[model samples]
Target chain A: MYRGLLWLCFLPSLLFGQRTDSLRIDFRPLLNGVALELEEEGGASAGAREVEVLRFYLSELQLLEGEEVVFAEEDHHHLIDAAQVASLQLPLTLPPGLRYDGLRFTLGVDSLTAASGVFGGDLDPTNGMYWTWRSGYINFKLEGTSPDCPARKQRFQFHVGGFQAPFNSERRVTLAIKPARSISIIIDLDSFFAATDLSQQYQVMSPGELSMKVADRLTRMFRVE
Target chain B: MRQGVILLVVVMMSGLAFTLSSPPGIAYPDHFPTTAYDFRAHPLDSAKVQLGRRLFYDEILSADGTISCASCHSPYNAFAHTDHDLSHGINDQIGTRNAPALFNLAWSTSFHHDGAHHSIELQPLAPISHPAEMGSSIGDIVRRLSEHAQYRQAFSESFGDSLVTGERVLKALAQFQLTLVSAGAKYDRVQAGKDTFSVQEQKGYQLFQTYCNDCHFEPLFTTGGFARNGLRVDTTLNDFGRMMITALPEDSLLFKIPSLRNLSYTHPYMHDGRFRKLRQVLKHYASRDVRPMPISANEQSDIVAFLLTLDDRDFVFNRNHGFPH
Candidate 1:
């Protein structure tokens, strides 16, 4: 009698559903052994400042398996400061006995978001990610002060964006996470500080092609761990 | 038994959906050009349009709750402010540019005097956030709109249970503007060969064809492009039109060519409203000394007559488009 009842329950459960898992994304910005240059002071370390931040937003997250993008979320620009690494928990219901081996996501918002109109909450321009005079959002914003930087005394800002062609820029990276494990992405400041010539690219507050270069260079630092 | 219940629910849902998604009232002239806005991206239901219409006239959009879009763009004046040369906003703050008449904007490629705004869906943010304009942020507007029960219900109906967002707000404004089609003009009748222009109007048409038609185009009466127009820069404002966005020196002094469809209703022409009357505009064009053209007195008169024909009386007095109270 018990076996028959168990079968009755198992039959419908087996026919209708599958197990689900949550994916966690962790972000980290590296600081050690990097030549951190600020715009205000000339050729000095950002470490000299008591408190400094290199913050930016990661938007339009997606999960990819091979060539196919499985999950896509547009208009989500989560700001990650030097203090807290931006993380997201996504509940996913996969096929029966299926395991996702890889994931892909863009580091910045796509062109469509920049072109779309005023959005409220996280997507609003009041968040400081938007440029009012010129239309377009800053995909990545790098702010801090270093003794080496020229604009050291005042708060220096490097907000990068501009999706229009000839200046379009937003970066994406893909990683393999076998067994479908949650991953932490390390944004090595060393790589970014090395790639950009701080003297020429110190205080960018608007969107344009130069900003695209900075964002492209920053995306190269993203890796799965 | 569960399957039967699910089936009943699905059937009920489908019937409800059909009733809510009924077609909207969008009658327009057969001769008008196709609308440039894609309604499919942001579909227009009467509820959303009505909500947007309320927001358009509500003074609560301003930081002080005293100035609304209609404050500068009045429906009685065909949505153009006539009290001042430059538009007045919150705190009686005068903007540097004239408030251009708003109508038939569905066909425009861009917005603003310098074409800084590329899409209709994003245009309201300019006025809403301008320091000299409404001076309110989109976040505050959404929060304020959310407090109202009517707006909440309208938003739910229009956006399928979505929250009141700036995107939805701007999209709704776009929906209302898209319906502002003005094709029932005397010129439209002439185009259909139902009526003929007087001799003076005919002469004006010839003059317009020779000079003004190059920039003002036809039917819509606007090429929707920027031009220098040979106007001297105001020392105080020193507004470098397209250069503000392009950052190119060659594009300096370039301003959007205004539409001449409602010339009779929209007075004080030019970006700054320097010319109060049509005669002044004609005289300016006749000088030709400005743009290196040769417009004689006779040609000037004809062009002015032709400009008057472009007026659409049906648009200015459309009862369907008056105050939404």
Candidate 2:
């Protein structure tokens, strides 16, 4: 009787098959095609800055095939922190046999979620991603030190976020890739820094024209290999 | 028999889960405005509300364990500090701007003097992390709560398990705050036909409707939005108000329009707490340095009489809203 009851519990999963295969969305931040290790001394030069903290929000993962979306993440607002190694990898669950040609995602928190107040898990206010003085989240955070900076302690902080128009910092990034278990996206920090005028325009702590411009350039930093 | 027992246990557990989600306990008169807070997101239960009350009163929320939300927003003063003009934090630290009152917060879409924060659930983070306020981070507070045995048990009762999180803490605090509806004033009684307004109050009400009703609306007693009330900017503070948040010149000198309700309990009006009495606030309005509102001394006294009727003694001293005994 116990065996029969236990079989009934597994019957739905076996017949209708509620099994899911998880696709790993992996991020590997590189400095000139080299892995960026935080707190690594000698990485900074006269103009070049050493990255101390690199954190950002990655949301709404969508698997597409030539303009047609096959799978989409309902609420995948993940806080990817460089300090936490495990946070670099985000897992998106899908049907076991599902397939797609391309992947797309928003580089920051969506406007709808920003207006919906606070939530738990990755979106919690305690994560320090949300702003204290304002109503928006810090969609992307990059902090470092350089010898060329004019600010306090030669440090630079670029916190980009704004939901309102004329200053919204959310960016959409897309890349075509073959079907694979683990999707590895290399973030070319060199391309980002090379494009940035870091010497003069380093400090962008609030959401504005500078933040919007920096967020637009971030889309080109991703390379799927 | 073993299979039957397992089935019975599952059915009983489901019943227990159903009892956990309680009915909405936020009580307000039917005449009040709809709630801006989403009760569906953070449902109000007795256990969670009770837990929030303890946290609000406890000094554990601060870095030096000397301040809480109540330290600045005392219940006796309609959850606003009357002893100090500026917000006092840990270690003799003084913050800019007067701490605003915290009653009927469910109706407010924006928080703080400048309306900087949009969500009440996430609003506490501003004061909790402010350098001159509580002087603590939400992450550190979660760590401290995780180690406490009493809090762990309280978390288990409020939430599902003893695992403490910033989300749970904020939601509980919001639920308690949402329950602080202040619709029991004599004005409400007059509206309900239980009492009648005096002749002077009636004249003041007419004058209020003609002059103040546009910004400080009727029923709720405020528009619940920001306005430029024409107080000369104090050079020492140099507070740009809403302009600081938006970085727009058009939004300069705009501060939140506080409710005229409970004005007697919430003394020292305005964003800077500049006016110690109601007559001084009226004098500034008539002074017309920023905006013109010409009124005689008798008219001002009549307005003060009407404002006094806004004080709700039942709400001010409600034991449920007070510090947990």
Candidate 3:
């Protein structure tokens, strides 16, 4: 009778479906080693710059085991906003008892989805990720204020996106990993800011040579901690 | 038995809701080509169309709540402005190009004179965010719509919730535009065998088929392709139409061909609205640098007569397309 009672309990759980676990990717915005919170001044290591906004799209997240495929999010496009704490933490639902040794995700939205028209949720134009005059998603947006920047308000804006060929900026970021409660990923902004000459190369609002290079450099800043 | 009965009621109620909320079938003439807009992606609903119409006429879309889509593309003008040659927008600022007419838009593959926008869903954002146009961002507009009680209710009715999202707003706008089909003209009646064109119109039709048919294709009256029509570049504007978007030298001076439908109501034609009369347009075409037409004065008059047949008064005067009362 006890066994049958336990089976009844198990039956309801089975009805719910799937003995699954989720992998949480914790994205930490760091100026070198220190976390830069909001519009707060980056520490001495970060060249006294202040990051106002940092948002980018992480799409088609997948878990890989060597050459074998483990899990794939075929149509997933996640907008990771540094301002929104929850938006940075990406949780991936996994199949039961699945084991993976590697992680792979596209750093930006694909050209097909960019051309497909308006979409709701994270991909929605309301998210402020889409370009208005030109039809395309701004895949990686980083706006900040630096004393060295030669803009009107000392503001530096890098809205990196170009889905069309010859300047396609979407890049795949694959990181070798080990299974754990959460995957720690750090976006080192210090290196990103250091590489640019803020005086001349601060503004990148449209798709072209500058935005494409910024997008390429952006894909390299994602490091597994 | 109880479960089955509940399911049946749910199904029936859904059917009832669909029948009540969705408008009647869109009646396209048999001669019209397949729609460029994939309707299967976002099916037309009456509630959405109504919601879109309200938004279109509402000045709240602008930053200062002074301008609306109808401000430039009025219903009485066949959705194209007449008071100005160039588009007028927020803060009494003038725009670069003419506001194109808004009818039979479902067949359009691209938006803007430059074809910068690929889809209708993303087209409104151009004017809404342009500094000289509505001068409002999509983010600001979403917030404004969310705060309004009537808009909230309308959104709920249209989309099954009070979520004033960019996608919903854009989709609703697209739905309303797609419903603005103008196949009720005398040209359509002639094509449908219900009416016969006058002798003058018939001769104009032959001329139109011979010379003008390549660019302004039949039925929809637009090939929906960009062409370099050899109009001298406006020195003040210095606009490089298709080349501005593509950045290719070959695409320089190429502009999206405007539809020939509703030429009477939508006067002051051309991409720049340089010609107030059809005679000037014909004259310019004949004297144009590229592929100049050899049309004469009498031929221009006959062509104008045939062009007048393309005007559909029913479409321009449709009460459904006007501002929401």
Chain B of candidate 3 achieves a TM-score of 0.93
- The positional error of residue B99 in candidate 3, measured at the CA in angstroms, is 0.6
**CA displacement after TM-score superposition, residue B266 of candidate 3 (Å):** 1.3
Each model's C-alpha lDDT?
0.72, 0.86, 0.87
For candidate 3, the clash count comes to 0
**DockQ scores for all the models shown?**
0.32, 0.66, 0.70
* lDDT value, residue A31 of candidate 3: 71
Q: Write the per-residue lDDT of candidate 2 for residues B191-226, one digit (tens) a residue.
A: 988999999998888888877989998788878889
Q: What is the TM-score of each candidate against the true structure?
A: 0.80, 0.91, 0.91
* CA-RMSD of model 2: 4.2
In terms of TM-score, which candidate is strongest?
2
Q: By TM-score, is 1 or 2 better?
A: 2
Candidate 1, B103-172: lDDT as tens digits: 8787887788988777777778789989899998877888898898888888888889858877788778
The best candidate in terms of DockQ: 3
Order of candidate numbers by TM-score, starting with the best: 2, 3, 1
Candidate 2 vs candidate 3: the DockQ winner is 3
Question: Lowest lDDT 10-mer window, candidate 3 chain B?
Answer: B18-27
- The TM-score of candidate 3's chain A against the true chain A comes to 0.89
- Where does model 1 sit among the CAPRI classes? acceptable
Give lDDT tens digits, candidate 3, residues A1-225.
999999998897897676778789999989746996878443223456788889999898889999677999988899999888999898888877799999998888988898797898889898888888877889999888888987876888999887876667788898999988798998989879778888989988777778878887887788899
